[model samples]
Target: MHPSRALRYALTLLLLPLGNALAAQVQVAVASNFTAPMREIAGRFERDTGHQARLAFGATGKFYAQIRNGAPFEVLLSADDTTPGRLEQEGAAIPGSRFTYAVGRLVLWSPTAGLVQDGPDLLRKGDFRHLAMANPKTAPYGAAALATLEHLGLVDTLSGRLVQGENIAQTHQFVASGNAQLGFIALSQVAKDGRIATGSGWVVPTDIHPAIRQEAVLLTKGQDNPAAKALLDYLAQPQIRALIQSYGYGLE
Candidate 1:
């Protein structure tokens, strides 16, 4: 081989491991309602950036406690804007690293077709034997559910018939498995392409409750982690934003 060409080949061999070195893993704590879209985005983020995201999904409120107690999560995608802001203010998360990633829509859903016709009226009639919802203290969606119930003046009436789940995912499972006649859940849980993918659901009006603005924040643990920064940046891409929208989340 020619000397210069041979030298170039040797240099290429020396630099080959750098590619793998540049790839890293970030630990993420995500809200349960964002499960599906986050999985797809994580796959794409790995493919496009060569970095891996190690994800843990659960209630944002629980995640906040875990983070404060020194969980190893480098990032948090909270179900509500408040938790992330609280973290930022408390110094658990890096300042100026938080942003709203998705605006969630709450829905009254049932696995049975037509059971949810005129959702507000159905609640008014108190016909269902059981209604499921997440634990209001630990889940933002659950809080919204209560706010909605309060708006419709059904809180007292439905109080006796309500079932609570530990988190939004489990709450959804309750309704989906027919354990409860219906539940209040995030629209993204059973929706795609601007429609519910299965079962029947009534998209609750924005006027009834506070907006569900989900936020992402880089935890102090991720401040210097390249993969953590990469993951946050990937979430802001137009393609990822479109994917979020397809799941029935609103964007600003």
Candidate 2:
């Protein structure tokens, strides 16, 4: 072959995978607490960037554990900072990859049964038979509820009435199924953008508990992945930030 043609063919072979890499999709492990907004953001990202993102949601702790065990996740959107920070420290996450995407809020919510009005008064009055909270060990929302109750001096009072869910979604399910009279859950589960839907809820005061500051990070495994980078960047856009805020979360 002529020298120019041979070089051109070799370059084309090398460039094919690079072009394909640019079109590859990114897979993300997202927290259940971020389910709604992430779904919305994913749609916008795909539409705007021509990049696809596949999402999987569960408790942040569980997701982190899975990622550590070699789950094929490119990014992690955690419900708290600790997990992502730890991953970064361990070099599982990309160095300096962590940032707060949103600050989560918790609420005392009940389906429209009119059984519980929105307030801390329900606890003081001893009006409810059961309350659902996430498990304080692994779920950030559950830990917040525990802190809130501890602040109110109601943990001892409600000890007999408390029911714990593995995560916020289960806590919400308990309330919705009428298995629990009320529950402490992430605000995004039942409302968005300062708007409440079918359920009646009381926004738990930030003073009552530690803030659920959720942080996200790109995994080291995703460094070369465009979809992961796109998502991390997509999260900071004004429109996406506004949508996140609408879901009763604070924009970072």
Candidate 3:
């Protein structure tokens, strides 16, 4: 090999490790309702940007407490806008770094066909032995479900038969596994290609419950992290917004 070519090859080899070193891995705390879509987006992000997103899925309220107590998460994808806003106010998140990512829809779901009707009458009729919902204190979707029950005047009558899950994902499992005849869950949990994929469900009206405006924010730990910023930017892309919508969420 020529002397110049040999020096150039050596330099290229030396820079390879440095490139790998700069590829950051961001720690993200994600809401359980966004589990599926986040997984897809995270994979694409890593592939396209050479940055990894290490995700932890759980209840938004619980994640909020953890972040406040010094959790090392670089980003927070909360199920409700309130939590992210509060984090900004409390200095847990970077100021003005928050944005609405998706609008979540609440649904009443059952594994059995025709078990859920188009309206709220089924909940009032009390035909099912049990109804599952996430813990309202921990999950936004759970809070929405409660609001819906209250709006339909079923809270007093159905509280006795209600089963609670720690998060919306678990609440979905409870109904999918037949542990509960029916359950309230995020539409994303059971929807695909703009429709419910299996079983039966009622798309609860917005008026019945408060809007589930999901939001994402950069945490204090991620303020200077390039990977964290990249993920946030990637989420705001039109293609990604369309992908989120395909999962049964509305886009802002």
Candidate 4:
């Protein structure tokens, strides 16, 4: 009944096959912007290997805070390269385990017809009453949106009309629900098989916005986990990379 006794029994369980199977399941924290593709990848990883991958999606900012606060995530797939690198530098992530998983793209999208037919030109025309974007302070997609607007020299001009979502999913929701009329969301969200739809979108040229290289890192806490390491390695294999690319990500 004592705490030490309970821990001893728990440790003893690891010697059993059932305990090993459960212990080998990898827990992952993924960025909301990459939700769709990650689902595909995680499923494949689980099927090919007996090890399961449990996934959580949210703003990278929120996930990073959770990981730092000691959330039990074994792997982190972030929307930006910097966060994983920072975690490594801070000794939160496993050293030498960080790598770019995908390059993301920002899209100015509308569910309605003709509202955003020709990209930035529609923004200048300003027929829509509202626009949605993620919090630039948090979502990398939001940061890309702000950068694109600035490149078009429309930031101050459209500042009053912006409705900022907490993350990329909410931004997509606002536009899809027609609450905001238009929104800047991840290209992957609106894609069927990694290509954009025709209702109208501007695949903000990679040249304009900052390069969005989404990175992944196996945390130092999970270094000894074979499942976590295998999953990360699976992501880089030619076959898996092809699958990811088909989901609209530029794999590195």
lDDT of 3 by residue, 1-252 (tens): 234434533443444456677678899999999999999999988776677999999999999999999999999999999999999999889987788999999999998988787658888788889999999999999999999999888899998999999999999999999999999999999999868889999999888899999999999999988788778877876788899999999988
- Candidate numbers, best lDDT first, in rank order: 1, 3, 4, 2
What's the count of clashing pairs in each model shown? 0, 3, 0, 1
Query: What is the lDDT of every predicted structure here?
Result: 0.90, 0.82, 0.90, 0.83
- Per residue, candidate 4 scores C-alpha lDDT tens digits across 4-40 of 4345334433443454354467889999988888898
Model 2 C-alpha lDDT per residue in residues 189-228, reported as the tens digit of each score? 8885565666788888898888788988999889887567
Top-TM-score candidate index = 1
- The TM-score obtained by model 1 is 0.93
* 2 against 4, candidate with superior TM-score: 4
Global Cα lDDT for candidate 2: 0.82
Sorting all predicted structures by TM-score, with the top scorer first, yields 1, 3, 4, 2
Q: Cα deviation in Å at residue 104, candidate 3?
A: 0.1
Q: Which pairs clash in model 2?
A: 192-246, 193-246, 193-247
- Ranking 1 against 2 by TM-score, winner: 1
TM-score of each: 0.93, 0.88, 0.92, 0.89
